[model samples]
Target: MRVMVLVKATEDSEKGFFRDPATIEMMEAMGRFNDELRDAGILLTGDGLKPSSEGKRIAFDGAGRTVIDGPFAATRELVAGFWLWDVKDVDEAVAWVKRCPNPMPGPSEIEIRPLYEAGDLQ
Candidate 1:
């Protein structure tokens, strides 16, 4: 099974906060976690994203179009980063996600979802 692990963004992330000692420690921990996943043959790909402020959003309504700037607040619910992994099943994906350390200082949340396989549509 394949899964996508979503990392939600926060205000500090959008503003490009400095990477303090704590942040570095957290990143090191995450690196170790990724190593574990790779050693277990689960990790396919993973990466962190640039701040939302560097991104752009476009919306189209019929003949009308609108462009929204970044540093978007709704980003709190948007994906700031992601991880793709191959696992045994949904249960295994969930277990792996549970082992991930929180990225943000506050209540960071990670959403895990299964990817659609070739026969899933059927």
Candidate 2:
């Protein structure tokens, strides 16, 4: 099975800032954790996104379409990064996520969701 681990953005992230608990030490720890995932052979890919100011959105209303740019207002709801993993099941993914270090300063969150495979729609 495949799963996505979504790292939610913090206010600092929206401001293009990396601070406090997100110090160099934390980055190094994350590197070690990523290495662990790689060694386990479950880490397919992962990435960290830049600030929301660098992003844009497309909106559609019937035949009408409009483009909206960022920085988006909701900081906590924005995604900062993602990790794709191939795992046995959601339970295994949860177990792996539980081992990850805190990815931001103060309070932060990571959401895990299972992905749909070809067989699932059939």
Candidate 3:
């Protein structure tokens, strides 16, 4: 099964602050973790995202469309990064998440969700 691990963004991330020394260390640890995941054949791809302020969103309603600018209002509800994993199951994905280093400073979180496969529609 395929899984996507979502790293939730914080206000600092939304503002695109520079990484502190501790954060840089955390990144290096995360790189090691990624190496392990790759050697284990679970990680397909993963990377951190830039601040939402650098991005844009488009919404559709009926036949009308709207383009929304970024630096989005909901700072706490944005995504900071993600991992695409080909895992045995959700359980395995959970295990991997448990092993991941803190992706942010202070309190942070990563959410794991299963992806829908084309076979599911059959």
Candidate 4:
């Protein structure tokens, strides 16, 4: 199965905390973790995102589409980064997440969700 592992954004992440000198160790740790995933042939693609302030949102309703600027209000609701991984099952993905370094300066969350294959629609 394929899974998208989302690294949920925190206030510190939204403010670019990972770029801080104090978090260098954490960044290094995360790099090592990614290398492990790649070495295992589990990693498909992954990268961290810039702050929401540099992003934009598009809202649609019926025939109308609205473009919203970012730095969105919700902190915990945002995604700071993500990994596209091909794993044997959700449990395997969960196991990988358990080994990930903390992506934030403080408490953070990583959500793993399975992607639906086209055959599911049959």
Candidate 5:
């Protein structure tokens, strides 16, 4: 099975806070986690994204179009990073995620979802 692990951004992330010592430590821990996944042959691909300010949002209303600049409050619901992994099952994926260290100080959330396989659509 394939899974996507989504890293969610916090308010400070959207605001582009400088990396403090604690934040640096957290990032190092995340790197180590990725290393572990790679060593285990589970990691397919992963990357951290830049702040929302560098992105754009588009909305379509019928034929008309609208665009919004980033640094959007909706960033709270947007993904800051993602990891693609191959695992045996949901339980295996959960166990791997449980072993990951927290990526940031305060309340950061990571969501794990299964990827749709060719067999799944049937």
Candidate 6:
């Protein structure tokens, strides 16, 4: 099975909390965790994202499409980063997430969802 792990953005993340001096420890911890995932052959890809101000949104309605600039509202709903992993099942993904270090300085959340495999449609 494959899964996408979503790292939800927090207010601090939107403000580039990773740039803060105090976050060095957190970064190191995350690096170690990432290494663990890679060593276990579960991690396919992962990376953190820049703030929403640097992004754009494409909204579609009927045959029309509108391009909206970012610095979007709803901080908690935005994704700060993601990981694509090949695992045995959602339970395995959950177990890995449970072992992860907090991605935010104050509060944070990581969501795990299974990817639709080709066999799923059959």
Which candidate has the highest lDDT of all? 6
- Which ten residues in a row are the worst by lDDT in model 1? 10-19
Tell me the tens digit of each residue's lDDT in model 4 across 60-88. 99999999998999889999999999999
Which candidate would rank higher by TM-score, 1 or 3? Answer: 3
Q: Which stretches of candidate 3 lie over 4 Å from their true place?
A: 17-19
Candidate scoring better on lDDT of 5 and 6 = 6
Candidate 4: misplaced stretches above 4 Å?
none
lDDT of 1 by residue, 36-67 (tens): 99999999999988898788888999998889
Off by over 4 Å in 2: 17-22
Ranking by lDDT: 6, 4, 2, 3, 5, 1
Position 83, candidate 5: lDDT: 95
What tens digits encode model 6's per-residue C-alpha lDDT throughout 48-108?
9999998999999999999999999999999999999999999999999999999898889
**What pairs collide in candidate 3?**
none
lDDT of each: 0.85, 0.90, 0.88, 0.92, 0.86, 0.93
Residue-level lDDT of model 5, residues 1-122, one tens digit each, is 99999989887666664778887888889899999999999999999888888888899999988988887776569888899999999899899989999865678888999999999899
Q: Of the pair 1 and 4, which is ahead by lDDT?
A: 4
Candidate 5 colliding pairs: none
| lDDT accuracy of residue 31 in candidate 6 | 96
In angstroms, give how far residue 27 of model 1 lies from its true place.
Answer: 0.6
**Candidate 3: tens digits of C-alpha lDDT, residues 2-121:** 999999998766767576887789888989999999999999998889998889999999998999878787766889999999999999999889988888877888999899999988
Give one digit per residue, the lDDT tens place, for model 2 in 41-71.
9999998899889999999999999999988
Model 4, CA-based lDDT = 0.92
TM-scores of the candidates are: 0.88, 0.92, 0.93, 0.94, 0.88, 0.95
TM-score of 6: 0.95
What does each candidate score in C-alpha RMSD? Answer: 1.7, 1.7, 1.2, 1.2, 1.7, 1.1
